[model samples]
Target: MKTKLWFLLGTLALLLTGCQSKNNSGSAQQLNLMQTSDLLSLDTSQHADLPTWNTLENSMEGLYRADKHNQPQAAMATKVVQPTNQGKTYTFSLRKNAKWSNGEPVVAQDFVTAWRRSVSSKAQSGYNYIFSGIQNADAISKGQKAPRKLGVKALDKHTLQVQLEHPMPYFNKMMVMPAFFPQNRTALKKFKSHYGTQSKYLYYNGPFKVTKWTGDNDSWVLMRNKYYYDKKQIHLNKIKYLVVKDANTAHELFSQNKLDDATITGVTAKELQGSKNLIHEKKAGNYYLRVNVRNNQPLANAKMRQAINLAIDRQALTKNILADGSLPASTYTAKDLSIDPTTKKDFAQETTPQQTYNVKQARTLWDEGRQEANLPKKLTLKVLGDDQTITKNVAEFLQDELQHNLPGVKVQIRNVPDKTASSETRSGQFNLSQTLWLADFADPISFMGILNSDNPQNYGKYHDDQFDQLYQKAILDSSNNQQAYWQTLRQMQARLNESMPVIPLYQMVESHLVNPKLQGVLRHPVGEDDYTRAYLK
Candidate 1:
């Protein structure tokens, strides 16, 4: 179940498309966008994928925005003032003219209701921990406290105050997410459990409003919100999103100008390289292989897990299979993120070998572990992966590499649809699975916090009491001792390496094809909503 949560975080950016064109002969009307992923559900609390969240972020406004540099900027809130001494209280003043698409006033109580619902025991939001520091959020989520005690209060129609159990430096950044976004209480009360179900029940207070949503159909539409406070800055009138799984066909549509943007596949990258519309972005995420520690099988052993990690040739996979500028990963964190600002070097430099494809080392370790465990004569491990070509290729490569390097070990490939794969991982149904983690915000805590034992995302049941304690200290401490925090983080990494619960694979390079004419387009490291200010030339 923990594996499913981590996997969901990684797969968010797997399918998004953008377009930009310099030829300005036509009028600036509706902006048509194409994306590869199909929205599973519009229920903000239930949907965890990036594509869905991205659309929601643009269509719905939040109290704050995580900027390109990873800093939180005020959005719906006019200002956020925190008490300097204790850092436990935050005062938020809403914009005077803020209102929903239906012209209803955007009140502070909207945020209060949304936060209370998210942390409610019945909500089961994977991102419930985002508010763990809130007054009684953790207790409420665990059913030990009531929603009213969850630290959020609407002082008035336009002002909200929040009390935290401890100081959190990233609280503002976390608020930029949908889990913290306000929901229409009227719609929620009327629709009950089906509040976000079709377009009608889903109200909007952001730059764009979801005008149409047909779940069974593969397409949906978003129109600019006329009542949005910053509506004058938004140029595109409407955005229509289509879900096309076939990468080749998607690229073909892009080439023909039928689609504004598309994610190029390995087969199409070279051909589209010379196109002026091609745009490449660095991904703030990492892909890895998670081994089920609770399986009580061969993979449950640390030695066997290390052996499998050493067997695969990640460099070859990146060059041959991925063909993207993805760097090999030696640690769970991405390369750029793994660097310690104080030392200006990677934290993994202190412990663990620089990643290499060492078949001899892998074979020896596997044989030793097999002998010690008194395992069956033949070893077989099941791998769960998404239906994407890249995932299938990676899984096949791992299966071949592990089997060829280790004499008795056999690998079975189980390629399931993305949703099904997610469900299986959440249900703890796999021996091994491919997963990725995208930072919820710029902070290292965004990635580190997910592994906490009580976190809903920790599906593999990997737990470390010491690591948990250090994480708590890092978040609660007021001193800006980032170096000390890194030191503690190094210790946590050491524990993860020793446990071998997961194998870090590679850090992906995000790329998209955009028309050169689309000005005001902002690309952030976290890639939150930057389309509000985007405009056509």
Candidate 2:
């Protein structure tokens, strides 16, 4: 799933409208915030990081945005419509009042243009996979069909129609994703290749507009969009963000009142234990180690991968290193994403052989795998991770645990910026890539599809014919048989546990020191927080 921007929920509208008049006073409504990383791209079709999506969600309006309770709510669309043709066909009537920052009316063709570009063969859009169930999308993505043949069209100026290959139960929830947002053809044609790389090249339709962003700058600002249809409900005049990767630095900025909101973890999170301003948000994402199993790497051996998985102490890492209420992960999927239709059981909580911490067993397996792969007794491997303080701490902890458990193995920790880590991992430049996935929507497929043998996001290059076959079966059953689909998912996860392509680490819990005065800031379970309804009291 492509990373999405954190958008304003519908439920906050009333509260925001009530406080709108009071916030008009100069400088009082501005909210100072901090991000662990800088924005990568403004283009929704290209960005795969959280910060970039967060910025886009604030700056662009989609067909439907989430309500405060995480329910589907209409944004650009006048109302959320029911799917026709057995849940395959959808017709949306967009709000006529909506206009782009450039004063161009947001028509249905904008969506068509963006959707077609995403599935075009030449684009190589990492997110085009999400359009799989849409008619002709798969063919277009594979270059078998033209982009214009994909099953989406603009009926008229304000009407958009979409045809799906199958009945997608979670399709409505996907409308809020950044990839589903419309693109201005005028801007695309005007800026050409430079489009979405900088803030100036894009047009805004959401509550906020990107006023200052140099694309590579660590500091940026979002100002209220005057052209937004619901501009009257917007309370915050400005949202400023500064990249502060160090937890200590974030806490210091928050303490000095330089930042109204700061994400703090590790020692800083532990220190703010009982503070009134502390907000603990358990995110619906998992952090795992992506093992490079391609080209006969040491991790290509299943036994070697299992040995590595068994050697890590997840409990200590989450409690001691993270100290942010994150749960140790036993599987690839995070908790609460889905429930079995028959048993009503949570997908992540379903019983399966667990990932255990057994140093003795790990050591024995390591030796066996080494001999089988014709490797030396002493081996060295490098682990790539983000340079953020919390991530760096986790990387260092993994190094210690692996080296300590496997006597002859030597581990090296390489810390780089988040963008660099993502780039390197995508290019298969590391033995082990410390990465994470924030689901685009709350479905098992969103997480499971990443490890698909042909998935672009499968940075580790792990492949298994059996796993891919089983995963395809699950996809086939998704629209027809819920029970069989759920069972297939369980089986796929079991297969993952056996292969150990990715080491399940922990389910993240974002701990933030948000100013008490900054009311109405909505923190979502799946993605980043929204500041559209926020106000400095």
Candidate 3:
């Protein structure tokens, strides 16, 4: 009887210990989510992919973040500022209460430092070109000027001033982009080359702080930032993410209640149908093809490029292969992204179809291209793409379509991890590569700017003097003459239609199984998913 009494006491003690540990971990206030790809990098300037940027959006605070209405809202900044100097300058007042994870106060100098570092020639930031209109930014990126002269200054500890080369109509909206996030110079100096490679090497000031990341881990956790300015408003105390590439695995995990949100597409999405837990989110992004025209003579031929573009049946790829509510793309920009101020027409509606499925025309163009270029009767080309289920499916479909429609062409599909595929394509090491671009802001130029001759992201190396001139006019006239700006963009789209440098496949719609109990998650059309205000109901 005495031994039984002791055993019961020990069991009660064990239960109490477990409860204490659970409370310490804040399990009740935690969220579990999934990402389709691994986290590549945490460095805002270096990362070009969506997953990394999305993670940054939650852990790092910028001057602005998108609200539920997809409008710019104050984050690190106390309020959004109106531009001066004829819309060429902006001065922001930062929140004095803001503090970084390392216990240092977040000041205006942080923005100045980060802006300079991003635009520096040595950074090789893929998104730095987004700062094209900033005074001296282009010169600094080209190594012609010092980073100190790159148009940003710390007017005071709490005030930041930015000068622009021209009036950027979207400058306010673009503040929410990851490229504009502040960096702690102390952390950078301490970690040096290893900064932002792991959770411990960096600091955070947003709603959450990354933990348990070891640079190459497939999983990570974000704990609530104790130092955040608006900490009381943040609901989820911890957010966890795991890389689940396969849709079936994600679905199974979601069904088992191991995940609060699961990203599923293709067959799984179609099967889910009308489930109350399922959420369909149409992204302001599009998947497209980049041809290595700079290195390949055959692909450089406009007829060859046009033939390749016309051969793919985008409708089948979207409806049959993707089957996730994705729309077949015709314009570079996704539909409903922007409506013309005067005409009130969607950007995609205003532009003509760049390329359409036409097996007959594709075959004719293929033969004529070969004849014009004095090429062989039979030709082979390799395509590089990510190994993700959806992307791989698309790549395989492209291979079959190109081979079957072009008659004399043999296609090879090479699948690699997203990171390797991105690097290889950027370096011009592939004949053709599959890529996707999401808008940095709400503007159509965010998509059209990729084809600019000066854009580093222009992997295809497409160049036309007239196209370049039209693009510049669009930017310069953006705030001055809206009608001229709109017309120039239309003209640019027509140029792409004729040149066929890049191929537009479809606009992506992300399908997910989110827990019905979770509430207040804001999925923005032009920015990362906002979870700061999310909580379990």
Candidate 4:
């Protein structure tokens, strides 16, 4: 009996030790995620993609950030401002307690420096057009004026004022974008050309600070900022991200418990439909095809563009190819992104149907286009897209469908790196390219503005006077004309589709496998992921 009791006590001690070991192993307070793509730049003005913006949003904050209910809430600022002087002037008061990771006070001058550089012509910022409503922004972007002349000023250490060229009703929401983020002037001057190019060159005022990204590295770390204004509420110690472009690899990592969040695409999304970890969110964005008309003989023909658009079976792509809950976009702007001020109806649902999948119609249009352009029936066009799994799947699908539907046209699918694809598309180096745009703010104009003639992002070189005029009129109407505003949006969308400069493919839906134990991770379909309050339960 004595021997048995001693043995039992030894067994109990071993069991307790094993249990404690397991608990300690599982208690890591880090959130591991798969990054969307390579983070191109830390400078907010230098890049326009979601990955870069999301990185900036994580490490640095703007005046406002989206809350739990996806509504804009204050970040650096204490409150939202109402524009004075009949909506032409806006003023803000800063939070005195906000400080950068280095313990420097975050003041109003930081905002002034960021806005001027972002709108300057030297930055080649894709979003400079967004600042057109700000006073002297257009002139500054044109190099006709200097950054000092910009209408933003720091009234004091805490007070900031802005003068707008026009009365913009939605200007408050625009503050959420990274372009409005304040950059540390001392840091910028210290790093010179090296600033925002590497993780070490930047400072953080948000919940986290970036590290280990040496300009072009695929992996990085977002460590919790001790100096963060709300650091006391932050639960996670660190957020680590790895650039796993392959969906299979990402899913495998998640299955092995190596990653807390993993994005899945193609058949993977379908197979994981009922899985406990599966999560899907409809995106506020659209993927479209831009055809370069310059030096591209076939693209100049409107009939050719129409034929290409008709050949695409968007419904089949969204439903069959991508089993995710993506929408078949008839218009360029996404659903639920914009609403009529008065009617409160979604603008995406109200636009007229622009294109359709008609094999017979596509073939007829192709023949007509061949004759119209006085060219041979055989046409060879190269299309550039990302080399990742889902994008490759889509490119192959389009190549097969377009060739089979349209007679004698062969599309060579060029798989390039994400950055290469973006540069080539913007420079008009390819015959056709697939690209996507997420709204910087909740505005239909954010989507449509990229297609304008003078817009630098207009890679297709499409120009229409009627569309521009109607769009301008809609933008100028700040008196809450819901009926006129929505109707004008419809007309603008109709004009783009009629011109056939680009073909609207489908809206996006992202699939993720999130750890059930992780709570308050704050996943957004657009800008910035909020992780300050996120905790491992």
Top-lDDT structure, candidate number: 3
lDDT of 2: 0.85
Per-model lDDT = 0.74, 0.85, 0.85, 0.81
Give me the displacement of residue 76 in model 4, in angstroms: 1.1
Q: Name the 10 consecutive residues with the lowest summed lDDT in model 2.
A: 1-10
lDDT of 1 by residue, 1-537 (tens): 899988886676343212223222122555556655556666766657766686787788788876656677888898655554477888899998988988888999999998888887767558777788889888887889988899989999998989988777767767777778898887788878777766767788988888667665667778878788876567777677777665577777766766666666555664566767877666667789877877466676677878888888888777666665566777676655546666777555554565456888888888888777778759888999877766787898888888888878889999887778888888888889888887776556677788888888777776778778877876764246777877777677777766677788888675467766566656666645466566656
**TM-score for each predicted model, relative to the true structure:** 0.90, 0.94, 0.94, 0.92
lDDT tens digits, residues 282-307, model 4?
Answer: 67888888878764557888888888
Residue 7 of candidate 3: its Cα lDDT?
100
Clashing pairs in 3: none
Which residue pairs clash within candidate 4?
Answer: none
Candidate 3 or 1, higher TM-score:
3
Candidate 3 C-alpha lDDT tens digits along 56-130: 888997999998889899988999889999999999999989999988999999999898888887775577788
Tens digits of per-residue lDDT for model 2, 1-537: 223322344446757866555656324578898878878888877765788888877778799887787767999999988999988999999999998999999999999999998877666447777788899998887889999999999999999999998888888988988888999989999999888888898988888889778889898889877788986567788889899999899989999999998898898888787889988887789999999998668778889989998999999998889987788888888886667676788888883455478889999999898889998889899899888888889999999999999968999899998778878887888889888888778887888887887776777887899999998899888888988988898889889889988998999888988888888776778655677878877
Cα deviation at 52, candidate 3, in Å, is 0.9
Error of 1 at 429 (Å): 1.1
